[model samples]
Target: MTKAFASQGDLTEKKITFDEVGRDLWAFTAEGDPNSGVIIGDDSVMIVEAQATPRLAAKVIEKVREVTDKPISHVVLTHYHAVRVLGASAYGASQIVMSEAARAMVAERGQEDWDSEFQRFPRLFEGHESIPGLTWPTTTFNDRMTVYLGRRRVDIMRLGRAHTAGDAVIYVPDANVMFTGDIVEDHSACYCGDGHFHDWPGTLDRIRAFDLDAIAPGRGGALIGSDRVNGAIEATRDFVRSTYRPAARVALRGGTLREAWEAVRAECDPKFGDYAIYEHCLPFNVARAYDEALDIDTPRIWTAERDLAMWAALQG
Candidate 1:
């Protein structure tokens, strides 16, 4: 049997932090785990990112309780990813919100994605049995929408697609902070399994235009200063450019997937070797990049069976 570590392992839950950026804006981040954000309004609260499961989400809720007693009336999904939106039920939210494109992506491949991700990282789905079903958005906007948290304003915008076809950023203009769901990662590897390599840089440019002083990325710690925020965006962009572009070039040149993976490892490892999820992300990243380089608009589904088959083909 695979042994679990004493202090930590994939399944180990990390401590949650209630990072206060301003009076009412806060970030609930697990130690380098998937992070969530809390926005407290005059009379209500909104949760950004629902987490992987209800059990995992409760940890975030616990942090939220430490700051406010307002009922969580809105759950915003920056994008449709199993790890980010599956825990909506735990929030007991009045209305769950997502971009129109995100909702469409959920409808298109939500089930396949849930299966693929669970297969890739079984440890993250500790209490898989508790998941009620696919999370559906109660409300979805086409491009941009704004919400008022008492007198404070929160803007949810589907700026452009990068990490996913429907990537969104939650902007707290008052605090000059933004919650970039997978669009901006701080010291964490970009999971390009379902990403757009070519358009991702442009998306990062859109995020950089925010003039954000602070940012809570989809993974890693909260960036606290404007310089750090810019660093996060640049780092994330560099990962995409350095890792996937060469992989795409190799694939387009008729190089094998194994060859492409090797190219990426050699090129990226010297830089991002220690970043979280780099090893696990590379194979899928190469596969998706290969497809996109060939003009595949949508990423192909990754079933467990397909994952192994691809791994075996690349590994051999």
Candidate 2:
């Protein structure tokens, strides 16, 4: 072990911000850390993207309590990631909602992902022992599902794959606000450990078609205006494109994995080096980009052993 694993050295606590993006829509952002969106309706609330654990989620719970006493009736997982879905139990939402693809991923590799992410990001999993087990969704939808929070409509749609096979977004038509989980990041590195790089740009195009006034991205501060929303989308698209294009080109030319990694670092580091988790995400991002460029459609499951191996290969 030459260098620390993903985000292991990132132990400094980030400042969390709970910004009201709409009348009842809130974004709980922690600098460049994972974010959670809160939608308060007439009588109840819906949480999007749970934190890493119950103890970590309690911070968000405290924020939720400050604004409203509404019971969290629904919890929506934008994708099947340990850091995003494991804290779902803390909300105690009766119906945990996600896409059918996400449910399958959870069933297939949820435990492995949990262990893998815990090792990669120990700071985020402050209370790893508190996690009862793998979080499972109570309800699953194919393409889209609309849930009413007392007349407020929150449309959850799987608008193609970017971050994962089952990446979904929560769109509020009335509020013109969209909650994109890792699909559109701002001033942060997009973790492409399990991403679909080839299809990600098209997904971003689909998201751009929406008439959104504000956006609550998975990381970074909430985008407040339409311009900022568009900027975030473009930034995310650029990051994905800049990262994958060079690696894919290297792979297409039958270059080695290290060559692909070097290509990406040479092209992207100048622009994205200062972003959070840039170093942590580089190897995995390059690996996926290399695979996708070689026509591998689905992302392979990431295990703890694989994480170490990949890190050692790239970093050592």
Candidate 3:
């Protein structure tokens, strides 16, 4: 029998873990579900990656309240995925920040992405009605922006493109911690449907250049200590390279998309098959890698129609 579309069959609720990764930084993870990072600055809080909906974000807020009462003053969208940004309203943050490229993506494909993701993963969109609308970034920057919550410094920088053309990381220089959005998933599959395969490794190198004591990745457990941080980075690099390289080679050799898909699965499944969302992400990841191998510089927008059609073709 055919597998359920994307994560539709994953209905069981995951156990949530709110652990302090650094002095004041917390990682809110849920058994490999989408994770969020909390930076409790001296004066206020900065939330990285809003949950899927306001109801979901409220759970994150409850965890934040357990630690401190400082208001969530800012919400940062590291990229423009619907699961990451649709919950922005719940935070009541004064400023919603994102990279300029991310802002453009919201304007261009936000609605389509919202529709696509809602269909793909119904469980994550539990409170779909609570979403005010497409989350908009009130503030945007091209390269980097610095915010000071009292004496602590939080740097939001768009190092390069990895998960998306606009991916950014929240760096805490003083604490030696980084909230790497989807750029570096610890044990989870990197959703590369909207990624830049060729540019991703370079982006990972840029992330490695930082002296990180801890990393709250987009998924999986928090990496605490420099050794764990480096390990996660290397694992992510290996995952990206292993998935893209073989698939790209197949496409460059005049192979069909199915051939490239099969090649990628043959190469990646043995190593990363058991990882979170590995099966759900494989088809899209291979599709993007195949296109990129043939020199498609930009990723095509994914709509609900496109999602179903692609899944049908690949899974057939």
Tell me model 2's lDDT, rounded to 2 decimals. Answer: 0.93
Q: Judging by lDDT, tell me the better candidate of 1 and 3.
A: 3
Q: Candidate 3, residues 1-316: lDDT per residue as tens digits?
A: 7889999999999999998998989999998889999999888999999999999999999999999999999999899999999998999999999999999999999999999999999999989999989999999999999988889899999999999999999999988899999999988999999999888989989888987889999999999988989999999999999999999889988999988888888899899999999989998998899988888888988989988888988875
- Candidate 1 Cα lDDT to native: 0.83
Ranking by TM-score: 3, 2, 1
Model 1 steric clash pairs = 42-150
Residue 73, model 1: lDDT of 86
lDDT of 1 at 50: 92
Q: Which stretches of candidate 2 lie over 4 Å from their true place?
A: none
lDDT of each: 0.83, 0.93, 0.93
Let me know the TM-score candidate 3 reaches against the reference structure. Answer: 0.99
Model 2 Cα RMSD, 1 decimal: 1.0
Q: Which consecutive 10 residues in model 2 have the weakest lDDT in total?
A: 1-10
**Span of 10 residues, lowest total lDDT, candidate 1:** 1-10
